[model samples]
Target: MAVEELVGPAPKGWKYKTLGEACKDGGGDIQTGPFGSQLHASDYVPVGVPSIMPQNIGDNRIIEDGIARITPEDARRLSRYLVRRGDIVYSRRGNVERRALVGHHEDGWLCGTGCIRVRLGENGADPRYASYYLGHPVVREWIVRHAHGATMPNLNTSILAACPFLEPPLAEQRAIAHILGTLDDKIELNRKQNETLEAMARALFKAWFVDFEPVRAKMEGRWRRGENLPGLPAHLYDLFPDRLVESELGEIPEGWEVISVDTEFDITMGQSPPGSTYNDIGEGLPFYQGRADFEFRFPKRRVFCTAPTRLAKIGDTLVSVRAPVGDINMALEDCAIGRGVAAVRHKTGSRSYTYHFMSSISDVFARFDAEGTVFGSIGKKDFHSISHIKPPRDLVLTYEKLAANLDDEVEKNEQESRTLAALRDNLLPKLISGELRVKDAEAFLKERGL
Candidate 1:
């Protein structure tokens, strides 16, 4: 069959082939790694080679941040299971079977018990092309259909080996991989740029507020009355030379006082209405739970309810009180929060300031977190009792103004990220399934000037 027949109508004639036929030997075989029981926790070392796990499998990529390390001796024992650069890693058992095709940087990574690594053979089949196919919605659906177990879904080696795929000629495979990789590269670049911008803002916040560098300079009497600070504008000069004083919390800069968070803001907890009262079919409000509801930009899953209470307004801050303390997120839409979330409404200036202020003090909240046998939670009373240093009204207003501008920029970046993510998700399935031909994609890209 022609390439057009395989990927649908084409402008030029090209060869077509099934994935199983293109590969010298179908897909790569799966090999399960050793169980966790084989190695002692004490065997784990710091800063050694990374030990990969199912949790390390992120969307379309492998995440190495939370990876643990094993000693040289342990590595030798697991040498046979070591992952190569082009291997595809799959979480064999989990609520969501995450899959990531290993990249060049992951050459020496080792796998954990929960993950099954697949090593492709030297046939003309490209691992990157196969990874795109495996990550497709059709493949994921097949995996879910064949997965076993009632408590936790799992895929055995036999099931994984039999997963079907549609593959074009080697040349077409390379072309498709290159096209998709280019888009991914751009997405990654945007992510890193946004991260750098966030880091710059965080540094500025630390310098002005946490480190007290600006306050200290002013306190030392080095700043001239009419001159502006190095990074700050001349308008900020009038607010300098803060009055230092002692308070119940301790010594603080002048014009700053210790105040209970509750007194300065209204705190409300979310409630999960009775299950009988739930109606998935009815016209209902968007219900958000704890940290799970929070994503890089907005909430993920929204529960429906005909009757909703405790609505969080746009720009309000949602703080997790249980499971994960100190996690903060901003509300982008009017939604109802679940029990484990605490919604904060600022009594004074811009709510954006309160979000930044809470984010800055996350470490403080971590220190006061109470551990439970099953879960960890922060007591609201204890949280309120913790004294917070509140700057003078005028300074707070100035900080709020600066914070609002920064928040606006952040919101714009988030909106862009959302748009890009949606485009990628929509195109991924069509591209992988060959429902949309590669030439069509190229034409589409040219039309968009991409």
Candidate 2:
């Protein structure tokens, strides 16, 4: 297909060239260093210079969260390997070759061994253009073909230097980058907003349940022998009379009770069929793994099986029971989960309340997880031993009312984010291929008022 057919028309004075010809040198320079053993977790205090690793470089993006840091002494030990702003970093030793271009935001970051950092020549190649080109399908295929090693495929400095691109003029490069960056900015905003909302809900839960502020207020009224408080309903009064109860776990509020997880809910482990049983015909049902199934978007890639033993209905909570503890998500459709996950169905009450309660207790379960050097897992026995603070029927009803409203708002924001992500992914390939021009993209954005 012609480029004009996808986008409107190319700008005047634009010249097309191969990426190698556009650069003064054949390709950018790569720097290597000693592995990450020089630093330890104790050496990493709260705030210091970031230490970039292969895991830090996401597919076509940079992840600033869950990063490690080092002290001045550690920095001095690895001084030669520090990366500057606008350096492109790529993973050299992994089955999936992850890559990301550094931005001006990360000016003086220290890089790890698993990545090969690239510095452009004096001709001033656009870093954003290089980033987009590296992420293109053709370039990735080329890297895979040239990758060396049997157990773990890898790319070295030489392979990365030879990766090709369809180079456009500098102005067009900047325009393409700017358009893509704008979409990313929106996605980042949605993520931050959702985090804030989730924090607010958790804070409210802490205030009322953990700190017992509401119970304290009620007790103060009873101690002074005064009338009921203004905000509290009449039935809630005298609910927390001066009393302490002992249980299997420990002392709890007077009226509160303890119960096993199975008593209140029906839980079952998921099963993964053998490789021969797996099919991508899109005929039977959706299949899922642990955390991959819980991504913000609904599962687009699906596997199917005719077996009845591997099915879970919508609204059932899918909890990761293995390696990573308590990664929970509610199913959006009838699906089958791998062995790493378990499905929970609430007994009779509102599933919303159960979901929130499980989320609240997730941290406690994580603590009881069996520790190991390589992998840690939480077994069913440990999960069954978890103690829960079961509130009275009226309080649970109150929690349900408040939580449902907040959850509705969260779901609305999630849906909008999904739509924006789809649009962004659809436009990225076309724009980078020169099949879609900047003017057409701008017009499309204007029509949507974005």
Candidate 3:
């Protein structure tokens, strides 16, 4: 496609540039990672400098957890591959479009064995501008066409350097970056805040239900029969029986009971719609095949079905039943599903507790049901029989009230991120191509209070 048709034409003073020319003009450098031999698996250490590989890149940032690390000495040995703040790292294989800019938090980290790093020169383009440019849809399509290795799709410096670029004036470039970056900063803050809120919810769930904190307190004489616990009000604390009872599963708080999944909640084993009924343009309801569609606690919009054979209500817990099973996501709205997933709703109307409880136990399903080389699945009979201790109804209701606000906030933050991302995508090409002037963009940002 012609660049103008795709990204809109630039204004009078703007100039066309290739990635290589822009970088050469700006004093930028681009290189892929050292080969495996240069950064050996054996060189990695338990606790030291991190080596950022493709997997560490997520949500436009590095995911530090589970990433490999190497000793400080080894990091020094690979100093040439080190990433600095303001550099952008791209996955060199499998997914050429995925990239993350190195922020202050990632400064001086090793750009691990299967990635590429680009350091912008001080003069050519704003680092943030170039990073956002790389993520823009028009530029992404250009990069896709230039990518080598059709089998898995790969990126090399030569191919990347030759890709097309649009060069607006440096001042306009910074303005565009500022507008987009403000949205990104807010989105990231929401993500971190949601993480903290979810952690707090889980901690509260663990304390009240799994650990039986109230029962333990009475056992240790830390609580009196009629007194309120330190954190809970007297009426709420009174819901927990101040003793333990032996059940088939284990010692549960008094008045709680061991129960099978079906007895305590509702389960809908998904049924696939007829193949012809599937659509991509949101024909009817949002559709999901399995946990692969999940994004954090919610699922991505992948497909839809004109004729849905099974449905999930909003807030219901969705569980993957096929291979790589037990992954869970909550329904953000009523949606359609295929056989690889199941929808679960609590009978007591406390969906948040059902979500948290199912997540806590999904591991049990994943372990026992794994089979087949590619499509391991659990049967409906086996799923219904999965058992667990149920906290007394009143306590569960109370916990739901305590947890609902947090869950609602998480959903709201996710929705807000989606809206911001849409706005970014809409403005990206216009801003980069100068169809929207810097002053206009700045006005939009100000009006949005960015």
Candidate 4:
């Protein structure tokens, strides 16, 4: 049935309307953010009112990391662009389909350059429901289709004003949003937890390997035999040598040898199969090209290749080797990789160590990107020839044993998040379109304790 159709013997009071009509009825308006002339790059300050840029837009939420800020005076000057609670922000250019819903936390933030804001009146469709409706694949495709610009699509007030909107009774709108939101809340919680877990693991890897903290502690007499010191455990006292040795890279722990990357880990440079063999329908193996496919710790399933070339094994560290270097993600399953990525795995089969080690030397990999005149790239020769300080086998294994436990928890959380996200995605369109009754969806979620 059409989403706007009424169900049962009585009309559900749902109406089909343009986004602008709904906003006008609700006492809100659609507008573009401040233009470049109104706000220049130099106006940005270290600490002030945050200006929501395109990069801050995440999947239905505002991402604060690396967000730009303007002085309070500047924000006041561009007050018209200031977003309030319930407003939806869309990128003006590039990925115009993705957007973020303004929340209480983001109220009063300037809808900065390269963005369009949609504010609905409280009396209109629920803002939360509107956000989901716009996210519907059909709606997103429409936006992309109508967006201006050939190379990069751009969204403007006119384009967004004509967006198709479905308005149900306010109460029903909230109910549908609540059902889908419950699943999203769980998925968001998992994402945050995984971030914390990964941060802890990375910190340990940096301290133990990069800084050689244990050896330094022993040298300073702070670490006694059979006694623990912070992260250093008493049981592992014999693992570290109490001295530093000069190395080609810098000072490293004694007894550790400086060796090329190829010596300790097998490096497999990815080779792309023919473009005709690639498909998004998952006909064969999951395929990853480079950083575009990478997420927090693993590559998201996007494309698939019917004719596989170079492949990454499950748990191998995937590193981007072209354009921009050093971005890392682990393969969650056996997958085909393209030329832009390289798969690395420790010869001794320590996934945790290999993952963290690659993460630690991001600076080294970054140099390859920066040095290039055009697009940066690290070829097979340079990739394998990269130098690294290799610690004793037993020490790496011990660190891996402790680190793997933490990583395992992260993996579990990520898996749960993916499942919750899938559930939310499945329920979203049905609930929004009234194909599944809100009450039925609510009861289904309650049964799962979502």
Candidate 5:
């Protein structure tokens, strides 16, 4: 029950401390971002400094996909708001639970509007340890509770400074950080690799089907019309006839069919469960309605349903069928569906093709939504009739042969990310509270080569 009995006299140098005490009189200080009016939305530019916003802080890391940028001049104009390496940025408003540590690559990135930054001292807490400590469940609970604002939850520098931290000796702090950072690094690696793999598959799809690169190659004599290209084998190249053929969907490969989705997918528009049946207790089945419930390539299981009207199986493509329609996610598990969503499975049993097919026609679906609806949405009737290109069966098989392994790896990485994340989450409070010693944590991490 006591520190000594729990983990051997707290491993000699553990202390109960508040962030304010640890950070005060040292370089580890904290502050909120620029005032909203100081950094207007009009100042955003296509390219310049990477400005970290609340949305950029994803799953404990700074994800760059959709980050806004500001001009170098503008960054200098707000130079005092600059975020440096080894700093932790917290969302100042909205989803205050989310935060990200600035790394070397993010050094000098603008802390940006709508966030708070904590600068670690050169001689105080290890930055990674501090960031991880703040993210631990107990600390996060305090953060959420102390957070101010009714509709839009707000976090500020004062709230962050008032939070408690369980401190170990500096060396032990770094060791604990090492253990957690290893897991985080691997998770980040997997996320980037998945993005790369998805891009590769999409490029292949565009070349063969959308752009008809093979057909264009043959027409230009870059590739023999009926023969093979270097990487392509057999009569596969013959599938792309040397000339374009006119179709309702415009120029497509000679033998490919432009087919309606009704013939393409075993489609089911979702039916929402009764409001009384919905809960956050993991009641019966995972539920999703729109993009808000989506994670990268998969749906986030937040709420659950007891009464189900429509459903999806693992790997079925889950699509947003409401306003801002066509954003896609694959079912990570069987889930109860809601009215704003739809699920589809490929009749041919090609999971990779099924998702890619929908993604390739996303613009078409969006356009159709614009034309037929009062709002931007695709009704079940319209979704059922959406037209898509049916690439040659053999070509689809060929693409599958090349890309199925990529999808399988992404799924495996996702599963590992979940497991590693769980491990890290479980260990954080234990290690800090001295219930689990750094040596034991090291053993656990080492066992996994972390």
Candidate 6:
């Protein structure tokens, strides 16, 4: 495919070259990662230098969780595959368009089997700028179109080396990267803050409802009237019963009762609409099939249905009820859900309580996945059969009052991040292609105090 056909001709003073030409012009080279024959599965160790694989690649970043590691000796043996700061890495197969830019923290890490490494020459293009340019929708589409293989798309050094590279003056590249990076930095900060806030809410749930900490403290005499202890205040000591009693779920606060999930929340199992009704372009409501549509706390809108069979109202907790069950997200707005998902909401309309409570019961959902046929699933009967201890309405309301503030703050940050992301995406192609000058972009950001 012609590069100009996808991105149009490069602006004046800009040059378009194959990635290999650009790399060689500087001094760098494109290379494939260590072959499977060179590094076997047995070489992986519990703790040592990380070995980046296809799964470790995220949106221009390396995700470290569940990353395989190799011993220092093995890493030394595969030294040629070590990635350095400014180096770009791509998966060799599947999701061929995804790539990540190496950072200082990942210097010396091995580019493991089924991956490719691209190191730009020192005198060549700005790596950050190149990284962003490669992530542009047009570039990604080009890569996807060219990748080889029938079952799974595959990539190699030759494929990547021949990909088009658009170069601007080094200074202009830096400016563009800086503008985009600033928005990304803010989005990352919001993501981390949301993680912390979610953890805090989970911990509070475990302490108050799951562990019965306050009641236990009162029973043990560690809590006293008009005296404060960590996380439990003196004024709130009276909210929890002072004694523990035997119940179906074992020892519990005296007044608490065990109730089925359906008794506490309204459940709406989804029904998929006809395939002909689905479209990528916005037509009606956003449609979510299952866990695949989930993000940190909300479902991303990818599919829309002109005729939605089932609907989930805004703020309802969406739970995956098929295959690998119970992954959760909340409906940010009223949307359509497919058969794999179930929408849940507290009968009292406490979204905060509903989300946290569902999150705290992974074990309950795990059973469904383990016991069913080849592919696990949970019907409404099985879903509603799971029981939970019911605290007093006043206590549930009190927890909701406190947790809702934190949830609200999380939502505010998420909204700001979304707006910033939209602005960044809108500016990227224009800035990279020189349609929008750096100074003009800078002035726009300054006006917004960005």
- Which one wins on lDDT? 6
Error of 5 at 98 (Å): 1.1
lDDT of 2 by residue, 412-434 (tens): 67777778877877777777777
The stretch of ten residues in a row with the least summed lDDT in candidate 2 is 1-10
1-450, model 3: which lDDT tens digit per residue?
333333566677776666777778888888888898887778888899988999888756788878899999888888999998888888888777878988998899999898988877777688888888888887787777778885888888887777677777788778789888888998889989988999888888888888888779878888876677787666765777778888897889877888899999899999998999988988899998897789877889989999998999999999988876788889999999899999998889888898888878866876655655666688799889998987778778888998999999999999999899888888887888777877898788778876
Question: After superposing candidate 5, which stretches have Cα over 4 Å from the reference?
Answer: 1-12, 225-227, 279-283, 365-376, 448-450
lDDT of 6 by residue, 182-271 (tens): 998899899889989878887888999999999889889998989997997788888999888998889889989998999988999999
Off by over 4 Å in 2: 1-28, 37-47, 101-105, 120-123, 217-244, 296-308, 348-352, 367-374
Residue 84 lDDT (model 1):
81
**Candidate 4 lDDT tens digits, 321-417:** 9978988998999999999999999998889899999988888898999998888899999999989999999988987898889888988988998
How far is each candidate from the true structure, as Cα RMSD in Å?
A: 4.2, 4.9, 2.7, 2.6, 3.5, 2.4
Deviation from truth (RMSD, Å), model 3? 2.7
Task: Give the CA lDDT, 0 to 100, for residue 216 in model 2.
Answer: 66
Give per-model TM-scores: 0.84, 0.81, 0.91, 0.94, 0.91, 0.92
* Each model's lDDT: 0.70, 0.67, 0.84, 0.89, 0.81, 0.89
Clashing pairs in 1: 3-14, 243-254, 244-254
In candidate 3 the C-alpha lDDT for residue 245 amounts to 81
* Residue-pair clashes per candidate: 3, 0, 2, 1, 2, 0
Q: What are the per-residue Cα lDDT tens digits for candidate 1 across 262-308?
A: 77777777777666545556356667768867765456545666666
- Candidate 6, superposed: residue stretches over 4 Å from native: 1-6, 37-48, 245-250, 371-373
TM-score of 1: 0.84
